[model samples]
Target: MNVDGALAPAVESILRTARERTPGEDAERISVDARSFSDALADAEENGRVPLIAEVKPTSPTTNGERTDDPVELAETMVENGATALSVLTEPEHFGGSTENLRRIREAVDVPVLRKDFIVREEQLDAVAADLVLLIVRFVDDLEGLLSAAEERGFQVLVEVHDEEELREALDAGATIIGVNNRDLARLEVDLGTFESVAPVVPEDTTLVAESGITTTADVERMCDAGADALLVGSAIMDGDVGENTRRLVNA
Candidate 1:
């Protein structure tokens, strides 16, 4: 499967899987009340630290294997330890995630949940019951239309962008929450500086989130210093003691 220069083979493969995948019966309904990811972040910021959106990623193309912790239990621990929200990977084959994981985690925790997937169509939104949904700029054909579709589904869109052009597209699409992804999907390489470079160009009113390659307290502080309202972390939390790691990053 070929893709644009900005998309890596791994990401391209995930999109292919997403295209072929269909929503289950449960996806046809919305089961829970949607929490406000924006409100959660705003409330956390008042506490004097950058808010954390810890991820419930069982596995990834870059990781060795799936997490041993139960998804719901891990999500509860994250919320208990101070995660402002949770990001759940729902792409099954490469990421080892499922909508069931999102549903269970959403039911178990009070914080807003983010359905992180390679969303390329509106049908994907039907399967998501999260408060927030990730829309990577490079994956979707019409960013504005998709954003509207997501809004119609009662979700706050977290538009993920890898570069300045994508960032402009997101802003033009009227995205209120934007995530600066440091990992270049084309090569699957992470560089924390990506956020630092893009942060200056984002509007002050936009709720900015820094994603990927963040692993330490220093990294968290670096992003906060660069004007990130929230930080989305996965491998750092899942690879260590979930509670301790969540506390450590949340406190940072």
Candidate 2:
């Protein structure tokens, strides 16, 4: 596969990280007890409320360092404040995240943890024991194969997309859970309309997650109104009181 699609610099950095890992280390095996991430998300809403999958990214290419000094503490606070699941950034370089963060956060919370990283190889999948994993459609050459591999590794897939074509591609690749990233990979620009525009085309059976640019209660409501089952928020929640910000979104 040519993998000729134009990748954003942040994603390119992730691919570089994957390529740099030692051979067997990339494929190093792990055995974790099965936790149904699909069900965890599906059951998150018990009283007609949208679930909030709060994130623990230390930083991003756009945002250099994290506000939270203790990621595990922040993760615990989120769950205690009604977070349905957790999204932990495991990308070390640009994001300032590490597998150590995911491991600690996962142990602190019973809710499913999403291993959010630029996953390009099967070995990357084996490195984390999180219950869920992210798979960006534009970032990989074989979407179906990676989705299947994640499932085989006992993790639910959060297949991300930015447009109609990518949505269709994800569906065709058997993506049961789809997240519409508001930020365009090419320009690294955000517009929540990305979710509104592509949502109607999504099947009712597939779980829909809204990622990025969701900062306020209104933002949460907007995403819910646009048919999102959940929201994957990081920066906004991490910027202030984790509990308060999380509860605000949860109440939204």
Q: What are the runs in model 1 whose C-alpha is more than 4 Å off? A: 1-3, 24-33
Clashes of each: 1, 0
lDDT (0-100) at residue 111 of candidate 1?
86
| Residue-by-residue lDDT tens digits, candidate 2, 13-109 | 6677866753244456655675666666667775554598999877787665566479899899999888889999887777878888999998888
Clashing pairs in 2: none
| TM, every model | 0.94, 0.92
Error of 2 at 26 (Å): 8.6
What are the clashing pairs of model 1? Answer: 8-186
Superposed by TM-score, candidate 2 places the C-alpha of residue 83 at a distance from the truth, in angstroms, of 0.3
Model 1 Cα lDDT, one tens digit per residue, 12-57: 7888788888786566744435788778987887876459999999
What C-alpha lDDT values do all the predictions have? 0.88, 0.84
Which ranges in model 2 have alpha carbons more than 4 Å from their true place? 1-8, 22-27
- lDDT, candidate 1, equals 0.88
